[model samples]
Target chain A: MSGTFIGMPAFSPPTLPAFSPPTLPAFPTAAKEAVRNPTLRRNLRYATHTIRAKRAAAVSELDDWAALREAGRQIKDHTLRHLDRYLLQLEESVTAAGGVVHWAADADEANRIVTGLVKATGESEVVKVKSMATQEIGLNEALAAEGIHAYETDLAELIVQLGRDRPSHILVPAIHRNRGEIRDIFTHEMSEWGRPAPEGLSDTPAELAEAARLHLREKFLRAKVGISGANFMVAETGTLAVFESEGNGRMCLTLPETLISVVGIEKLVPTWRDLEVFLQTLPRSSTAERMNPYTSMWTGTTDDDGPRTFHLVLLDNGRTDTLADRVGRQALRCIRCSACLNVCPVYERAGGHAYGSVYPGPIGAILSPQLRGTASDIDASLPYASSLCGACYEVCPVAIDIPEVLVHLRERVVEGGPAVRQGAKVTLRPARGHAAERAAMRAARWTFRHPGALRAGQRLASGTRRLVPRTLPGPGRAWSATRDLPKLPPEPFREWWRRTHRPGGQAPADRQEDQR
Target chain B: MSSRDVILGRVRRALADVPDDDTPYEVAVQRGYRRAHGERSIGETVDLLAENLADYRALVHRTDAARLPGLLARLLAGRGARSVLVPPGLPADWLAGELPTRVADDAELTPHQLDRVDSVITGCAVAIAETGTIVLDAGPDQGRRRITLVPDHHICVVRVPGQVVSSVPEALGRLDPARPLTWISGPSATSDIELDRVEGVHGPRTLEVVLTSED
Candidate 1:
């Protein structure tokens, strides 16, 4: 692996853009809103279950899938450990291949770099392939601010852009909206963007697809610049790869005079050899295909073949901070297959919109906070969005332990310490919400550590079990109201164990591991 | 900052933090990962592919070359397809028999015209038996990428034993890595949120594989 090269711009502090999208409700509120939409829930339930079954069947066919998953995990972990070396190698190789490599520290910096690149092209409008990295940095918004327009070429993405909607799923950005809603979005909004919907555009799949195809066809042929994200970056060869079901990506990549790819640094694999694992895992895990229909790979620019000028923006945006933590770094292993999202029960119910990022689902629960930080109310609320059912873990092609990371992030949030800023190592001040929980936990921790105090406290609690309120007071009341607090036994387990076993008699088998 | 610069900076910093030694890459083990996690071998990998293909509702056939052309013609005839779209560079012998078909050149046809074609036939670049994937580059025989997309039925020919690979690393060695590669395991399909499986949302609806073994 190589390290970062290209004289890329650094991220300045994030400036809250004037035109922020509808503020994502705090997790509970958004989730509640999502649950009430019966049509959306039905769509989610149907889609997730069917994909889950196919994925299980597909995975069951591979006796070595477990091994493949482990290999993917290990390779990613190893790469992340020495990410700098690989990034440099990547930069040198890409540059040597006639591709310019740019470095972006955060979303703002990344957007600025991309906007500047477009401005330099002297093109006010660019065609875009569905890229998560670009969305993360709010590049489209930034470009618009600089008087540049980005036309989305992907069908679902076109629907999203036309409707002025935020993507709710990684693979299917418009997964939250149904066919009827899509028909309305296209018919009412398509003309404003470019071509209008055909006369009598119905809610049928064919009509909707036709409307989008016509809408995007114009953008693909006329655009002078293309923007994209890669599925994988081969470090040794400096090749960038994109896998898609539609042929739209191929057009955007090949048609434009100048092509810009803004990729997350974690997208790299050491060699083209590493691509095999992801190519297989990505299609199968995401769309439940043995392989994707279109897997487009380009190395810099080719002579009279594709784009003449190729630029790669390798983005960090809190990735380095994410990589520093041993346990949390497992997130980089994600191939963005969306298998975890398909199998995620919470995602099926609450929908992707509730997660409040372009990523959505289980992967988003852990990834967004680490990358964006748990500073804002929405970011802090993401970790608690899961039921920890581990469906996401079971389906992950790259085997990201999403629940583990969610719990880890939750612990960080509840620690009530100062926030961890981008590129900085120090912890900032306690977030207001977690202060009470942190104090309570600290007192409980001190009590648990002292055995004498623990046993006495347990007895007191058991005797007063009836007096305990069914619902907790203050912030906790909402939680206990919906859930049944475990009833206290007649006696604490410690007392029961002591009475059953003689003191110093091997300390009882159940407690042996704890003692060790 | 451009999106490129934002991403590149982070990648630069990430690369800067890791040590320069090649030990990490060198010690990156693939075998132990499989051993500790995967218990199967290459033969089992082949079996997985066959089984998974069948599970996806795709028709899988094992045939010798002498029997392949006849078998494929029969399969097409059964589907009531009058003419099949043949890639310009497809092996002549694959369709040597007397079957009436209109060959579609990937280079000349538009998306609207290709959609009207009944079936498409081409040789695969590589077949990952472990994942049951069929890759096609616009190599000499594969033709343009759109032919595979517009048609509802795709009959991909795979020369078994020769083209098969047990792992992704093995497949990567055979590919150009920079070419426009199309990987197919089965027909293109998607599910609604209600868990209803719908095939042919974008690509071909039915996929048929004729595994030819001349050895």
Candidate 2:
């Protein structure tokens, strides 16, 4: 638990690290307001339906999509298992190729490393691609604290940054904003950032696109430093690949003099050969295309083409911990296709903002809690966000069993005390409420093991069936308010079976032949 | 510390714990890239290139060297494309009596000028079957990458059977890693957060393939 301890700013208390008890706007209230916005709902419905349909069609074209998904999952799992080895391989390969690599254990170290890198460059401004890793680390805000500016080049990301609004979706960050809202944000906010929007700018797609293009063009041309997060990293040759529809990612990757990529250690695949699976699954899964439009790949740096210097920061904030959990480790296999998000009923209604992290929707629910640790109200609340509908697991390109993981984490949250931060097996303590649940489970376990005790308990419960209340009287009342509590049977199945056919409680399979 | 040293230091430290033994590349990773990427066998790879090209709303046709000129004439006459843009190294007979052909001299014309032409046809460097991918290396017949990108329609003629590979590794082995390789999968597309899809955002909306097999 005690490593370097370098300037790790705690969020609230002395012990808690920065954003440990991660702060979020009261989501229940915000989501209530969001649901009421008719224009937003219309925009979301139109957008999600369109993408979902295209994804389905694109996915359908492949006869072995299921096998492909399994292969993607297996590859990711294998990589995560040997992450330390692959990371070292990537580092050696990159260094040999003249590229630099940095290790960041947590958010503070990551931000400091990147900010220091930019400071060394002597540039106060950097053009950035739409990178979820940067948002996760709050890198832009960290840079802003030091008076450095980070310009967002992606069109959707630009809208979110300009409006000072959080991204509400993964694939399309500005999915929450309508055409009219975007036009207003552009016209009013564009000048402060760079180029001003034209007078009387309309809400048309053409005009809004032009305004964003004009606004970002200058940054792309003049910026000396560029930052990005790669979709995948090749360990064999130390290459990184970024898939983008717009040419903005390509420009940011190529135009700058010094390029810094903050990549998740989980992003590495063993070789370029492994990249093929994702190259196929990722595009069709996320953008619903047979393939991505612009796929820019660079192996370290080269002379007279692309960036002269390249630095890749491999981040493992909580990936190792996540990878240790056998059942929950599959969450790291996510390719960020956002197909699960698109199909999620909860995300569709609540939007991405309510989840309160860079990653939103069903994947976010499981991933956030595991990565950040289930310490805060937000992390605790995220596990319960899903309906356990299993749609996410169904549509996921990697076939991660999201519903199963959600349930497992819920049990861990409800039944155990905080685990030792650095331990082999999470040790459990008997807290009061958890003790009650544990006692009940233990009693049930004992009764099931002993037939005599089981019979007595069943008969006792069956006798009191009429006295059972339809709803609980206290805390359970609140839980039952939104759901139906199952009613007790007049007679236990054991008793019914005993009286009708198996009088001595002999095996039912033996009685079946006698009855015939 | 020197800039190179600083960067390399961080890399070394991060990778400090990795084991010395180098495990073979992840098998599943290679399988992922190869499967459903383009086509399986050489025959299927050619078929996939044809079908995918058609699926991208590209026109496709099959012909032999003996009938190549006649097929070209029929295609050009069918479209009534008065003229076509040909790359500098494109075989003369490929367009023999096809149309009034114009050679694409990269030094003389810009992308804007290339956009004015009705069609630009070239041969691909290699075609991947699993992802329906075609690689362009800016070779003599392939012209500049921008030329293919800017034009309205592209007729890419792939030599059937031989130019196809089942996996990206096979394709990568044949490719010169230093060359500028442009991998084309399908028509360009983008999606909004709500998942609305829009095609032809940047690249061509239509792709055409003419699979020429000697056998």
lDDT of 2 by residue, A80-108 (tens): 66676677798998888778888776677
Taking all chains together, each candidate's TM-score versus the true structure is 0.78, 0.75
Taking the tens digit of each residue's C-alpha lDDT, what string does model 1 give over B1-215? Answer: 64444344444554454566556565674633331125567557657667766656567888888888888788888788877888777888888765657766744454456657888888888877655677787665767665666566888887877777765566778888556666665665433222234444456667888778757
lDDT of 1 at A469: 81
Evaluated against the true structure, the overall lDDT of model 2 is 0.72
The per-candidate TM-score of the B chain, in the order shown, comes to 0.81, 0.78
lDDT of 1 at A360: 88
Q: Which CAPRI tier for candidate 2?
A: incorrect
Q: How does model 1 do on interface RMSD, in angstroms?
A: 4.4
Score each candidate by Cα lDDT.
0.74, 0.72
lDDT of 2 by residue, B90-148 (tens): 88888776475664545445334554677677888887665567777667888655556
List candidate 2 segments past 4 Å from native: A1-21, A25-42, A198-207, A417-469, A489-516, B1-170, B176-189, B199-215
**lDDT, model 2, position A373:** 74
